[model samples]
Every structure is written in C-alpha cells, then in structure tokens.
Target: MGRVVAIANQKGGVGKTTTAVNLGASLAVAEQRVLLIDLDPQGNASTGVGCAPGSVVRSSYQVLLGEVAVEDAVLETELPHLHVIPSTPDLAAAERELFGDEDWATRFRDAIASIRMQYDFILVDCPPSLGTLTINALTAADLVVVPLQCEYYALEGLSQLTNTIERVRNGLNPGLTIHGVVLTMFDPRNNLANDVAAEVRRHFHVYETVIPRNIRLAEAPSHGKPVILYDAASRGSYQYLNLAREILDALPIQAA
Candidate 1:
C-alpha cells in the first residue's frame, strides 16, 4: 500500500499547499506514482496543479459527500504518474454537513482506503484550520508533514497543533505519525529566519532540507506548472526534487 501523508498545519500561508503540489510533482518526476488530494476548500492545490476550478466535473466535495467514489473523482494531470482529486468551493459545506454525523471523522479514511493501493504516494493538502475537514484528513493519514515558514511567529501556534495531533493519535488513528517538519521560505540574509530555523530544529528536530524563499517557487503556480517543470535548473526546482528524495529516504523500504 502507498504511504498516505497529509501536508497540514493549522497556520495559514506556511507553504502547505505549495509543498504538497511541488513535492507530489517532484515525486512523479522521479518515477513514483503519486496522487495529490486537495482537501482544502480554497482549492489552491487544484489550481496550482493546473486544474481549473470549474472545469473539474467531479471533486473531493463529491467524494466527501458520498456522492462519488474517491477513485472516480481523480483526474489525471499533465505530469506522468501524477493524479489529483481536485477540490471545489462546494467542499466548504461538507464541514457543516458532516459535523454531527457519527462517522464524520472517519469518512475520508474510508474513502481513501478504497484507493490506497493504487499509487506509490498519496499527498493530502488540508485546510488551514483545525476544523472538521482537517480532522478528517488527520484521521485518514498515516503521517503528517507540517510546513513551517521561517519567521518570528512561526512557533506561536505549534503547541496547539501538537496537542491536536496527540488527540488524533490517541482517539482516532493510533498509527498516525509526524513525518517531519519542513522549513519553508527560509532567507539566510534575515537573522529572524535563521533564528526561527534554529528554534524549530531545537524543538522539533525539523527536516534538514530547508526550502529557501525563491521567486521561482512563487511564479511556477501562476504558469500552471510545478517548479521542476517550469524551471528545472532553478534553485526551487532542485530543492523540491531533493525534498522528494528525502521523503523516499525517510520511508520504510518496500519492494516496488
């Protein structure tokens, strides 16, 4: 079975969606069959991967609502071995609709279980809050990859997130584990960014590869392409490719 990883953090603009998109694309480029699931209602991951918001006939909304199977909602991306379960704005309503349902938390887990063996990796881009949708993603994931922006306030909400993860591990998915914390938008010139990196490393034993603040990363999505495809020679592309390799290294070896 594929490793199901949720790229999540309750904090917004920490490069969660960007990491999910670029990492998934890089993994695909490395010959891994990858599925990028957009669980965030904002649908940034969908657009980042070049899927137009209204163009998708089926999406995660339908899957969450039980209107369609998760596999049926998956769309093939331009990248070979890369597929996406796009998200639409309608997914926002799923939070309220599933709130009182007894199986609300496990809905995504059940949905993903059906298609777990079809890919090498399943990356879930979660919403920017600790709402029902994020909870669902957490319940469904085997590991969580948190993207932390290198800034002064980056650690402010980490305690809350850790507590939430603890709750999920204890009450929902007992096998859920933290993959590792990734430092995003790092600027070596900025003393604050350096301090943030050091602090995160000290507290969380963050991943060694830190994604620098590169314009290429920001521009890639506008061109409807991943950094690797947009500018393979650029620092951003090389960094994300390395990130993909690091992810594979961190995983348990299994025969392909």
Candidate 2:
C-alpha cells in the first residue's frame, strides 16, 4: 500500500501547500506515483498543480459527501505520475455535516482505502488549523510531514500540534507517527530565523533540506504551477527534490 503522509502545520504561511505541491511534483519526477490530496478548503494544492476551476467542480467535497468515488475526483497534473483530488470551497462545510456522524474522523481514511494500493505515496495538504478537517486527515494518515516556518512565533504552535497528534495516535490511529519536520522559508541573514531553526533542530527530527525563501516559489502558485515546473533550477525546487529523496530514503518498504 502507498504510504499516506499528511503535510501539516497548524500555523498558516508555513509552506504547507508549497511543500505538498512541490514535493509531490519532485517525487513524481523521480518516477514515484503520487496522489496529492487537497484537504485544505483553500484548494491551493489543486491550483499549484494547475487544476482549473472547471476541473475542480467535482472534488474532495463530493468524495467526502459520498457523491463520488475517490477515483472519480482524481485529476491529472502536468507531471506524469502526479495526480490530485482537488478541493472545493464546499469542503469547508463538510465539518458541520460530518459532526453528526459517529465516525466522522474516519471518513477520509475509509474513502481512500480503495485507492491506497495504486500509488507509491499519498500526500495530503491539510488546512492551517487543528479542526475537524485536520482531524480527519490525521486519522487517515500513516505519517505526518510538518512544514515549519523558520520563525519564533512558528515554534509556539508546535507543542499544540504535537499534543493533538499524540491524542490522535492514542485514540484514533495507533499507527500514526511524525515522519519529520521540514524548515521552510529560511533566510540565513535573519538571526531570529536561524535561532528558531536551531531550536527546532534541537528538539525535533528535522529533514536535511531547508527550503529557502525564493521568489520563484512564491510566484508559482499564482501561475498555477509548481516551482519545479516554473523554475526547476531555483533553490526552492532543488530543496524540495532533496526533501523528497530524504523522505523516500527514510520510508520503509512494504511487501506486496
């Protein structure tokens, strides 16, 4: 089965979507079949991979609502092996609707079961909150990849996220584990960013690749393309590729 990894961070502006899109693209380029699931209502991951407005009309919203199969919602990306389940604004309403169901937390996990064995990795882009939607994603995931911003305030929410993960592991998913923390938007000149990076490294199992604050990385989303497609030689693209390799190397191979 494909490893389900959620790219998460409760704090916004921490490169969660960026990492999801670029890392998915990088892994696809490496000949890995990747399924990029957009759980964030913003749908940035869908757009980052170039999903058009018309294409996302039937999306994760319908999938969660049981109106469509996971495969029915899957959209092909520019990359050969990368596919995405686009997110719609309607997904924001799923939280309220799912609350009445006793197994709301397992909806995503169950929905993805049929397609789990079809890919090499299933990467979920979670919203920037520890709300019910993120809870569903956490329950569905086997591992989590946290995209942490290299800032002092970003460190503040790490404990809360970890606590939430711990609770999920204890009650909802016993197999859930944190794969690693990835430092993003690093600026070497900023002493505060450097200090925060050091502190995070001291406490967490951080990935070797640190994503730099690149102009190309920032501009790619607006153009509806990943950094690798927009500017493959850019620092952001290269680092994400390195991050993908690190994750691939770290994940254990399972027997068929």
Candidate 3:
C-alpha cells in the first residue's frame, strides 16, 4: 500500500504547501506515482501543480463530505506521475458543514481507503490551524512531515503540534508517527536563521537537507508550476529533489 504523509505545520508561512507541491513533483520525476490532496482551503497546492481550484468539477470539499468518490476527484497534473485533488474556498467551511457528526474526523480516512494502493505516496497539504480539517488529515495519514520555518516564533508552536500528534496517535490513528521535520526559508547570512536551524536539528528528527529562501520557490506557484518544472536549475528545485530522495530512503513500505 502507499504511504500517506501529511505535510503539516499549524504555523502559517512555514512552507507547508511549498514542500507538498515541490516534493510531490520531485517524487513524480523519480518515477513514483504520487497523489497530492489540497486540504488547505487556499487551493495554492492546486495552483502550484497547474490545476487551479475552480477549474476542477470535483474537489476535496465534495470528497470530504462523501458526495464524491476519491478516485473521481483526482485530477491529472502537468507532471506525469503526480495527480491532485484540488480544494475550493468553500472547503474552509467544511467544519461547519460536518458539525455534530460523530464521524467528522474520519471522513477523509474512509474516503481514501478504496484508492490507497494506486500510488506510491499520497500527500495532504494541511491548513495552518488545529481545526476539523487538520484533524481529519492527521487521522488519515500514516506519517506526518512537518515544515518548520526558520523563525524564533516557530519553535514555540512545535511542542503544541507534537502534543496534538500524540493525542491523535492515542485516540484517532494509533499508527501515526512523525516521519521527520524539514527546515524551510533558511538564510545563511542571518545569524537567527542559522541558530534556529541548528536548534531545530538538535531537537527534532530533521532532514539533513535544508530548503533555502529561494526566489524561484516563491515565483513558481504564481506561474502555476512547481519549482522543479518552472526552473530545474534553481536552488529550490535541487534541494527538493534531494529531499525527495532522502524521504524515499527512510520510508519502508508495508501492506495496508
């Protein structure tokens, strides 16, 4: 079965969507079948992969509500092996839509069961909050890869996220575990960024590849493409490719 990884960080601007889009693209480039779920209501991951939110007839919103089948909602991306389930703005109100429903937290998990074996990796781009959507993502994922920003304030929220993960493991998803934490937006010239990077590495099971603050990483999404497809020679592209390799090295596949 495929590994479902939730690219999560409750802290916003931490490169969660960036890592999701680029890493998914990189994995696709490596000949792995990948599915990216744009769980964040912003739909930036959809645009990042060249599938604009509104352009799709079915979205993650309908899938979450059990109105659409998971495979039917999957859309092909410009990349060969990468597919995405685009998110619409109305997905932001999914919490209110599923209010008082006992199975709200497991909707995403139940929806993905039929299609989990079709791909090598399934990535979910979680929103920047500890709400129902995020809870659903955590419940569905086998492992979590947190994108932590290189800022002092970012450290303050790490414990809260770990605590949330622990609670989810104890209750919702007993198999859930943190795969690793990735440091993003690193600037070597700044002492603060360097300090934060070292500190994060010392504390967490972090990836050796640190994603620098590259202009191409920011520019690619606006153009509706991943950095690897937009500018393969750019620093962001190369680092994410290396990150994908590193991720693949650590993953040991098992039957679902």
Candidate 4:
C-alpha cells in the first residue's frame, strides 16, 4: 500500500505546495511512483506540475464530491512516475457540502483507500487553513509533513496545528502521525533566519535538510514546472532531491 502524506500547515507562504511539487517530482525522478493530490482550491500544485488549473477536467473536487473515483481524476505529469489529481475553484464548495453529511471527515479517506495500492507514495497538498477540507486531508493521511518558513512568528501557529493533529489522531485517524517538520525559505545570511531555525530546532526535531530561499523555486512555478525539472542544476533543486532521499531513508522498508 502507498503511504499517504499530507503536506499541511495553516500558515501560508511556508513552501508547503513548493515542497509537495518538487519532492513529488524528485521522488519520481528516483523511479518512485508518486501521486500528488491537490486538495488546496488554489490549485498551485496542479499548475506547478504543468497542469493548467482551468483545463483540468476531472479533479480532486469530483473525487471529494463522490462524483468520480480518484483514479479517474488522475492526470499524468511531465515527470515519468509522477501523477496529479488536480484541483479547481469548485473545490471550495466541498467544505460546505461535506458539512451536511455525517461522514464528512472520512470522505477523503474512503476515496483514497481504493487507489492506495497504485503508488509508492500519495501526497496531499492541503490549503493554508484548519477548515473542513484540511480536516479531511488529515483524516485520510497516514502521516503529516508540516512545512515551516524560517522567520519570526513561524512557530506561533504551530501549537494550534499540533493540537488539531492530536484531535485528529484521537478522534478520527488513530494511525495518523507526524512524519517530520521541514524548514523552508531559509536564508543563511540573515541572523533572524538563523535564530528562527535554531528556535524551531529547539522546539521540534526538524528535517535536517533546510530548503534555502532560492529564486529558482519561485521562478519555476511561473514556467509551469517544478524546480527539479526547470533548473535541475540550481541549489534549490538539489536540496529538494536530497530532501526526498532523506524522506525515503526515514521510511521503514517492508520485507521483500
């Protein structure tokens, strides 16, 4: 079965989507089959992997609404082993519609269950909020990857996020666990960035690999490509690949 990981954080601009796109692509480059599910209505993950948001016919919206199977909504990305379940603006309505149903939180979990065996990893890119959609993502995921930007006030919202995860583990998904925290947009030159990293490290054992604030990462999305494909030689691309390797190393391998 595939490992479902939700890349989530309530705070925006923390490189959550960036990590989802690049890490998925890098893993694919390493011959790991990856499914990138765009749960965020913004659909940045869809566009980041070269799928046009407007052109996406079937998306996570349909999957969440029970209108289609997740496999039917899957789209091939430019990367060989990377597939995407795109998202559209219509996904915003899912939260309200789902609220009317009793099994709202388990909807996504049920949807993904059928297709869990199709890939090595399934990554859900959640919106920057603790709304119903995010809750659904949390309920469905086996593990959560929280991405924090290296800056002041970055840890301010973490306690709330941790509390939410605890609730999900206790009430919804008992198997849910935090995979790890990633430090993003790190600037080695900035003393504040250094302090923020130290503070975050002090509080949480973060992923050793910190993603630098590289222009290549910001520029790749505009070109409808992940940094791994857009600028493979760039430092950001290398860092993400290394991050993927670290993630893989951290996982316990199943006996053959």
- Name the candidate that leads on lDDT: 3
Write the residue-wise lDDT of candidate 3 on 110-170 in tens digits.
9998899999999999999988999999999999999998887878888889889899999
For each candidate in turn, give its C-alpha RMSD to the true structure in angstroms. 1.1, 1.0, 1.2, 1.1
In candidate 3, which residue ranges exceed 4 Å CA deviation?
Answer: 253-256
| Candidate 1 TM-score over all chains jointly | 0.97
Candidate 1 residue lDDT tens string, 170-200: 9999999888899888888999988888887
Clashing pairs in 1: none
lDDT values for all models: 0.89, 0.91, 0.92, 0.91
Error of 1 at 177 (Å): 1.0
lDDT of 4 by residue, 77-169 (tens): 889899999999999999888877999999999999998888999999999999999999999999999899877778788878989999999
TM-score of each: 0.97, 0.97, 0.97, 0.97
Give me the runs in candidate 1 sitting further than 4 Å from their true place. Answer: none
